[model samples]
Target: MEITSKLLNSANAIIEAKIDAKSIENKLNDIAKITAKKVKIDGFRPGNVPVKIVLDRYKDDLLKDAKQELFKKAIDDGLKDIDKKTDEILGEPIFSKFDEKDGNIDAQIEISFRPAVDVSGYEEVIPEYSTPRVTKKEIEEKINELLKMIAPLEKIEKDVLESGDFAKFDFEGFVDGEAFEGGKAENYILEIGSKQFIPGFEDGMIGLKVGEEKDIKVKFPADYQAPNLADKDAVFKVKLHEIQAKNIAEKLDEETLKKLVPNEEDITIEKFEERIKTQIKEDKFQKLLNEDLKPKFVDAIVEKINFDLPNVIVEQEIDLQFRNAWDSFSKEDMEKFRADKDALTNKREEYRSDAQKSVKLTFIIDELAKVRKIEVSDNEILQTVYFEAYRYGIDPKKHLEDYKNQGILPAVKMALIEEKLFNDIFKKDKKEEKGE
Candidate 1:
């Protein structure tokens, strides 16, 4: 066999493989010999059939099978030689036409070659990073949020249900004067201002006395998931039983301060405030590390590299972007989106450019990892996987295996490297800012 390669472009290559006719003949003879042992005819038992009979009965099939096997082996050998000469493959090879008419087998294979990029000067190109400092307002806001999470609800002796007050009520809903399923409740506590019920239900509860009964009319949303109720009009007979309001904790009080810091027996308001401040600082630092350092680092590396990416990588990135976009869109809106084929096609092409840039950036990052010898230890990966699984309320071992099978292991490694790079950059910037 002989192979010749021609570069179609930086991203694609064409290889021509020529297999010897004598070799093809030898394979066909070997296949025929193997088939003779299994051949059975009308007059002869299996393995005792004549060679001439076997040749007549199975010659065409054996030849076809032999040719395919020989071609596959030749292609494998050719690809191995190509990879040995050129470092790595970027994508799967696409085979073109095969000629079998004139006793010689000639085939063409098209492959996408990995991009060769010269990546350097990333450190110089990247902007100096600066750590964000937590502010008093931020800490105060965090404390307020924490207080809201632990806020207590107290019963109110109000005469009427009002906005921002919870109303305990008995209600029954009907469509066309007939009751509907899942439309009746007894002593249900619902916030008067919250749109947890149908649109008009909450509004109708307002201005109603504790013992008053009223008929509330509402229409289900057009995109409601229940097929029977979507866009349907209904009347609800509502009776208000009681009213309640939220009693938010005071920041300066002793009882509230103890709740804020549960473990500290003698925790003062000042100590609670200090803990909130510390947590705010840590959260702000992480946010800044993600928002500021990551983009800057990626931009810096992208600027230092120049290469054309394989189409497959770019397509994969585009798929990721599309999935993310689809996730954010409402179900009704997504149905409309799917109907707009031309618009979606245009949007996909527009996203493809962004995907291409992402693929190029990924290539640069991988090169950086190689140059820096960045590696994540098995223990580190396991710990990180377990931590993420715990956050999602999943079993760690199952999540780890799922992640590995889904090819997320490389993504995890890449994330670790990016995190390390960001830390290094931020530390250097901090030192410079402090005049160290």
Candidate 2:
């Protein structure tokens, strides 16, 4: 075996190896001897099967195994030549060239590693912002919302249905002079301004008196989820039967307090108010972090830092971005790409700059997390996945299995690490700001 390697960059390299016919033959015989010692062939004693017979019986399988072994050996020798370890490689080693000519094999493998990123002075780019402050008015508003959540519905003596009032009604819809599926219901309770129905449907229900029958005309959106009903004009015959409203409490009582915080015992109105204020403050802070501070810091660091990203990782990112964008392309645009190959290439190229930036930031976050000694435990990741699954009404085990089968668990872990990394950075800044 002859092996040589060249470093493409700090994180990438190419290994070229050639295995001659003699080496191939020797490897096959060695594998045959091992198989013979383990096999119990017909008319052959245990651990005494002839090597020649074993090789001839399992010729194809033995040759395949021999080739795999030789390829691994070549890669191992090449890594040594390049002064790299097998554990340092990122993704699977890509075979750029593999050919068998004149009873000799020539192979070339491309390997990449996580690039070293310099996040020194990254703290300087952290955006300065005041901590979120919860006002008395905001806390009161949130309390009012909680009160509404547990409010009882009562029949109202209103003559007309107005916005924010609930209506009990019967409705049947027709499109193009014909009734449609999923368009008819009896005694449906709907809030007048909920916008639960299609566009203009809720607004059309307003200003109707009890026992009134009217036709509400609505057109489905052009991009509606139901293709058959999309962009179609429909008329719903609605008969208002009753009007109702929530009888919200003007004051928070002990019973209502228990309902608001169901698990807590010995809780008082003042403590509940404090809880609401804390929640509002936390929500405001998260919004500021995610929407403003995080984006600004990420953009500044991505623009300020300079490093050569692994080509393989950038290309993988570009492919992912391109595939995701392809799902949203119009039929006409997709057809053009299918007709012209260059159009597809150009479309993919559009995402390359973004992909490079994304991959670069990923590495930066990884290195920064290491520098900060930030780590996400497997249990923490599982808890997050389970929480998300329950939130979306999916089975947690199945969701986790799907992520693993799709090879996205690492991506999930990376996302969590990035979140933790940035949060740590900002929290330290906050501590410093407060002289903590």
User: Please, what is the TM-score per model?
Assistant: 0.69, 0.85
Runs in model 1 deviating more than 4 A are 7-12, 18-72, 79-87, 96-106, 112-118, 128-130, 171-185, 194-201, 222-237, 252-254, 261-272, 282-300, 315-352, 369-436
Please give the TM-score that candidate 2 achieves against the real structure.
Answer: 0.85
Local distance difference test, per candidate?
Answer: 0.77, 0.89
- With candidate 1 superimposed using the best TM-score fit, by how many Å does residue 99's alpha carbon deviate from the native? 6.9
Instruction: For residue 125, give model 1's deviation from the true position in Å.
Output: 3.6
How far does residue 427 in candidate 2 sit from its true spot (Å)? Answer: 3.2
- Name the top TM-score candidate: 2
Alpha carbon lDDT at 420, candidate 1: 68
* Clash number for each model: 0, 0
Tell me the tens digit of each residue's lDDT in model 2 across 221-285: 99998899999999999999999999998978898898888898989999889889878877887
Best by lDDT: 2
lDDT of 1 by residue, 348-424 (tens): 78688788878897778777767777767888888999999999899999999999999898789778877765565
